[model samples]
Target: MEGILNAVVLFSNFVLIPGMAYGSQLALGALGVTLIYSILRFANFAHGDLMAFGTMFVILITWWLQSIGVGIDPLPTALLALPFGMAAAIAISLLSDRFVYRFYRRNKSPAVIFVIVSIGVMFLMNGLVRVIIGPNDQEFGDGARFLIKVREFKEATGLNEGLALKLSQGLTIAVTFVVVIALFWFLQKSRTGKAMRAYSDNEDLALLSGVNPDKVVIVAWVIAGSLATIAGTLYGLDKSFKPFTYFQLLLPIFAAAIVGGIGHPVGAVVGGYVVAFSEVTVTYAYKKFLIYLVPESWEPESLVQLLSTEYKFAVSFVILVVVLLVRPTGIFKGKVL
Candidate 1:
């Protein structure tokens, strides 16, 4: 029983909880990518930078709220400032559509053209975020730090292993659940969402059936912007926000989207968990976890990790390459591109 308990605790601490939280973040980010690919029909390479931009706004607002003596007790004030960040992100997305994307869209440019333009947009947003946030890590989460303290868990369970649940982890999972449910509801039931789906299915058919292409594009961008802000803010709260870190996140985010099925929302969510768990499980030093489970004489000397933490991000890329080579349609039958 003691061995079993220790094993459970080990898995929870190193794999289960962290994977779920990180999966939630990736799910949200991948959902945004999938939405753009579904509706706009191009990979929005600018998405990670958009997340950084939105998170930058949230950090600023959170700081302002803290300065003014306004806060949510036991919860991060960043949560309250989230809506403002989302709004700013939406405005920027709309403006970009009007000024930048709109021109290419009007010319009926090829998908590659849009992808290239998104790369340019990505650079612009990256530069803008760096200028505003100064390329430094910013910690904005302010409130109760842990929902469950390690000592409290150890005492309650009378166990050698203690489980610590951070507030940010709980918040990330909860928010992701709420957002995902709402998104699925919108996509599966709402009229405008149906129009978006119809547009995605066949552009000419959707237009002939009176689905307004412009309205669909606007709705998709709005959803993408809102999702990017929430995902970015939650990530920053859970970890620390750095402009470059979000840029790095693009690899995993895109990998999740591609692995799950580029244009499929459900695939995006599943792919997020897949990528997250793979990264954690592959890189985690399992020597300690194994020691508690194995017989005393059988203990191993080495860390027994598959890869170093420095190569964690590469896990996603490797998975992505394998998935593309094996099943480009992803787990779902989404467009290969």
Candidate 2:
């Protein structure tokens, strides 16, 4: 009885908490991609790089701030530097929109061509980040490494299960909530946001109705940039910041967006959490937790993880394919067709 109880506790601590935090991060990242796809009318292969660039910006600012002996007291100073990073990302997004995407758009290129252009832009951005940040990992987010210690929780709870949640994870969820609420309010309630939606629904009608298409596109990019920065910084703060890791993250982000239903903001949020949980749960060895749930005679010799650690990405891809097959529209009724 005690052993089974212990396993359950351990699983809750190790699997659920980490998964929730990661899902929040991926959801935020996917939201940015979905927004761009809706407004820009292309699958932005460069988005992953945009996230990388934003994190790189934060890394740079964090280094500068640390050099100046400036740091947040109880929280990571990178959180403080996030606004600047967000602005920088917005600028970059706008510039990319102007220089690369805008030209093709004006040329009346097919979306297939725009998709090709986006891939080129992705490579360019990847190279740019590599050149600037040198294809290296930069650890800049600092302060309050953990909000709770597992050992401490064990002492307090006196249970088999104990959780050690990070402050960055808490901040990521809180910030994501705030950002999501603000974003939805803007899209569902605000004028400019409604205008953008209108433009998305019918570009010609929006133009005829005196809605400035350029303004809407610019606004969408700005929002996308902000989301990219926020997601990147929070993720860096939670784990570590690596420029290349962001590129690698694109697969899961797409999975989340696609699984949650593309172009639906709420879906993006849900999709993020779903992907996060899937990644963690699939990779998490459940032996510790399951030992408590099953009798000794039933206890398997192996760790009960559904997939190996290295197969996390594979798990995400599988879930995405399954979701698409089961419900093409997505969990939140996002547009699949």
**Which number leads on TM-score?**
1
Clash list (residue pairs), candidate 2: 3-292, 4-292, 7-289, 9-161, 27-272
Q: Residues 205-316, candidate 2, lDDT per residue (tens digit)?
A: 9999999988999999999999988888888888888878889889999888888888878888898888888788878887767667776788778887788888888988
Tally clashes: model 2.
Answer: 5
For model 1, the run of ten residues with the poorest summed lDDT: 1-10
TM-score for candidate 1, please give it: 0.99
Query: Model 1: per-residue lDDT, tens digit, 78-160?
Result: 99999999998898899989999999999999999999999999999999999988999898988999998889998999988
Residue 79 lDDT in candidate 1? 91
lDDT of 2 at 94: 90
